[model samples]
Target: MTQDPQTSSDASGAPASSRRGLSRHLVDIAPLKASPAFARLWIGGAISGVGAFMTTVAVGLQIYEITESTFAVGLVGGIALVPMIAAGLWGGVLADVFDRRKVVIASSLASWASILALVVLAFWEQHLQGLGTHAPVWPFYLVTTVNAITSTVSNATRGSVVGRILPADMLSRATALNGISFGAMVTVGPALAGVLAASIGLPWTFAIDAVLFTAGFLGIWMLPSLPRLGERVEAGWPVLKEGLTFLRRSPNIRMSFIVDAIAMTFGRPYALFPALGALVVGGGALTVGALTAAGAIGTMLTSLFSGRIAHVHRHGIAISRAIQVFGAFAVLFGVFTWVGMHSGHAAGEGWGGTDFSTLALMALAMAGMGASDELSAIFRQTMIIQAAPDEMRGRLQGVFIVVVTGGPRLGDMYAGALAAVTALWFPPLLGGFVIIALIVILTRAQRAWREYDATSPTP
Candidate 1:
């Protein structure tokens, strides 16, 4: 094994895939030392992800308790979309123009600080008389906004770091590891958040989130300094324009974004979880935990042995197939829930978890969706990180951040809107089918995406 400064040139330059021959279709995931730097980052990310999950659950629970409306919870996520996108793009641009490590550090600190603010609010709720008496929405929105912004920035920077540290050959392994971390977070964080919120109150969850963010900071701090990729530019619209221009030239990348957006917008079923848990699923909060955890469990299972995917040169095709699987699962999830509703088991009104007895079926559907999503994510993330130029990584990341953040919100809108007109289960049932059909159609229509070889990428 050897380390060379000139390796990146191979990634971007002509002969297309000198990293591994086309014949080398698979590799052992564990032996790919890939980069120790990335390994450290992965560990830190897992920690932060767990805490982030806790905060997410806490925020939703608190909001639901305060407003007693599912709409409010969905609204919080949708409202934060703009700032998150802006911060992500800006953060990516900064990563490209400045030291990525520094950008990550600053943003990580900001994220941690926001959580600390949440911590303070928790104590205030417990101790301060006036502060706790009048529960305000603005502060909650503000803290959430700050958290979203910083989180996007941090993600963009971290992604850029992945592009830098790992050889092209091991991207799948890296992607798999990322999936595992996220899976673990979802599996661990939400359940913990629910318990903490139930027992210790909401503030403590935020405090835990603050502590978790620190692990990411340490990972970034420990990294060797890296120069900005490509060229440097001023921090405003010019940088943004450059990134957009790059995206425009690349049909696959653009299409990838569109595909993800569609799936997220229509097929996302998160906002409906509470409703399903209460009215249809037959369990209470526990059902929600099981459903969500089921999905994470699916993702974790896939990721555990995903070492073989590193050999795949055709990432585009992989993503397309994975997304279709995601859609199919979503449809199944909806079907089971819909069945529960038709069986005269509703929380009596709108769709709340209706049948706690049906928990197993719901969990299976959620798990399917989870597996498909994780697989799709592995390819999508790899494409984004490696294909984009180093100079515009930040801005691109910002855009990426928006897509990631807004996808579920769109799903929320899909579920909420469809539920208003039709039924709670209709959104996923219909949305899932639509997603699978569209992703398959789109990928087949676009041959370039299918041929997007990771080793020697065509941008």
Candidate 2:
């Protein structure tokens, strides 16, 4: 006979009432030892990501060495934004429509080819065409542009694979794990690149990236075959239109992109680091590099204990809060910079002069920026991966890549323009406040997103 309802507490004692259900939901998550495939992918990605980071730092140094123009340095992302978008979006549709594995493999190969080409160019040019000695801008632009496009495709396809390989329940864990891998790369990659560039040569940097390509191939090759979605649709505007249509109806995905855009547009201030390091703060190029790497360190620290993050269900809430916190950190960074700059004016006590305390404070701000950004990024990727279907995950992820990659490019312009017109520290401080305001403004307008449940399907 069934026990009397009155005798037991909390809704018939079904062992799955809201409170207990919530507890069980949290109890389940993947252990690192479970999936060797995931483990292998994570390891390979970590390795390749470091290589990518090396290439990133190398490119910046090379460009600066060649042109000695901040504007040219900004152009790296600015010029590539369009093709990256085109390739990323189209690549996403292809991922959903074709075999995601093949798409990733092909893109990886293309990226590898570009890196190898750079190595070759460096070899011949250093001796014959005078690469490092003379600095011809054309080849620099050509190889980098091609590399950016291929990398976008590779990025989108890899995201699709994450959704496919991991079950829905484990997406957050996988995403968190990926963050750790990415963090490792970011932390190690640039430093290694800087060391290698200074010691061996830029050509060797490119060569290193070429070697890393094989690891990515191993990651992809080990994956099981993934067939395209059964549905056949036209490739061009219609497929793109489909992605847009989904976003239009999906308040969560839509809001995530919109808020992130707002944050980037207003809060992003990386472009100012070099300027501050030189004219405003006083450390020089090495200091700028330190501030850049500090963010990666924050990300690495967050990933070290991502266990608690998996239990949070109100992810939208998490996103909004993390971003708000991020904005605050950015604002504080600017404030510290401004105060330090003025404080060290004539007597040389602060950042602009000979103030050691000033340098430490700036480093702290940069570290805070890194921490806030890492948390936001973890939530951001989770929303994208779990919300979209496998078929369209690639395209959606592609759009995400474009958003992230493009956001800073716009920030570069914003920072450059504002700094030229105003004071040195104005951009980050002013932009940080704007980010806070815009996030409030944007999120208040989207109630549907706030109510979105990750467990449900998109209508």
Candidate 3:
């Protein structure tokens, strides 16, 4: 009888290994072990991420404190969106044409400078005796906008560099590690920002980010030069048009972007957290922090045990299913908020009041939603990075950043506008249904997308 080649034989010619290898399904760390450069970059980014989140929270608090209007606070994201989009696209072209290491290093310095400017402004505001509650909002916007643009470019450049550093088989595990880094950033950064801003004030928060920015510089500086491969194109409108044309031809890639846009646009409920904490959940700032961190906690946990996901072959189906689960959790979160609001709990109360039961339920729902979204992100990113050619990876990674970042900004607008007319709970409840139904219909129409295989990527 013929024997299977995969099975090991004993000295007596009997099969020695019959049990299947479960380790193959586990999160593979070969990429980290094989490449020292990738490891340094990853560690630096993770450390810097904590500082970045601190400034993000501090800036929003400063804006709201000065203006006292939700509209003004929302405008922070809206104002930066257009310039960020342009930077993302333009940066992609530059990454393809220039040395990626130089692009990243230059952009990192610009970001560091912007953070330093913020520190100076914060000090100026504190020293002025008669400034009262309001500090100049324009400078805050200006520095943040500059920071946003430079950070976008640097992120796009680094993403393109990942493909060059790691092998194709290890891409999925690398993405999982990235998700873990992001999870840590979101979880720890905001919490630290709140404590630091309250105790040490805004200047120190910005200063911390400025100091951490050096790690990013060090990581980029250590990398070997990465010049453009194959035919090079000038960084201009023609290059941008070429990338778009390629995107237009790749249906699977287009669908990945569309699905993510849909999920973020309809299901994101972060804009309502402040209102819900104060008037509905009754824990005020503490409640808001809990809700915000819950999602990141879920993301971190999912990535920690992402052993099984590495073996998934049908990426499209996995993405669609994960997103659907995310939508379902969003619906549950909305329902919990609505019930809590009507349950005679303390409304509009400050931080001292507690509503543990309702807060726990809402947090659980948000955690579920976060985990599912992270799963989908891992698959979608892996598909793009592995499927796209090395030459076009930079341009595509730029587009990916734009979609991922821009989608939430659009969602903020959607949730804020709808909550103004209706209750804060109405938008997520309705939007969740929209996300589920729309994704189902869209995926059904694209048969090729549902059947996408990792071993043989179509796009």
Highest TM-score: give the candidate number: 3
In order, the Cα lDDT scores of the candidates are 0.74, 0.72, 0.81
Candidate 1 positional error at 247, Å? 0.6
Could you give candidate 1's per-residue lDDT for residues 1-459 as a string of tens digits?
443534433222323244354322332344235567777788888998889988887777666556665666677777787777778777877877888888888888888888899888666655643455636656787898888899888888787777678766566667777888899999888777766776677878788888788786777888879777554567777867788888899887787787888878877777776666656665545555567788888888777756446546798888888888888888888888877877776563212534655667878877877888788888788787778766656667677767877777667766776776788888889998898788878988998998899878765
Residue 349, model 2, lDDT: 16
**Steric overlap count per candidate:** 22, 2, 0
> Would you estimate the TM-scores of all the predictions?
0.87, 0.85, 0.91
lDDT (10s digit) by residue, model 3, range 384-430: 99889988888888888888877876777788778878888888899
- Candidate 1 — what's its lDDT? 0.74
Q: Which residue ranges in model 2 land beyond 4 Å of their true spot?
A: 1-31, 120-133, 232-234, 280-285, 339-356, 455-459
Prediction 3 TM-score vs. true: 0.91
Tens digits of per-residue lDDT, candidate 2, 184-220, equal 7877887677567656877898799889878878987
RMSD of model 2 against the true structure: 5.6
Which clashing pairs does model 2 show?
92-395, 344-350
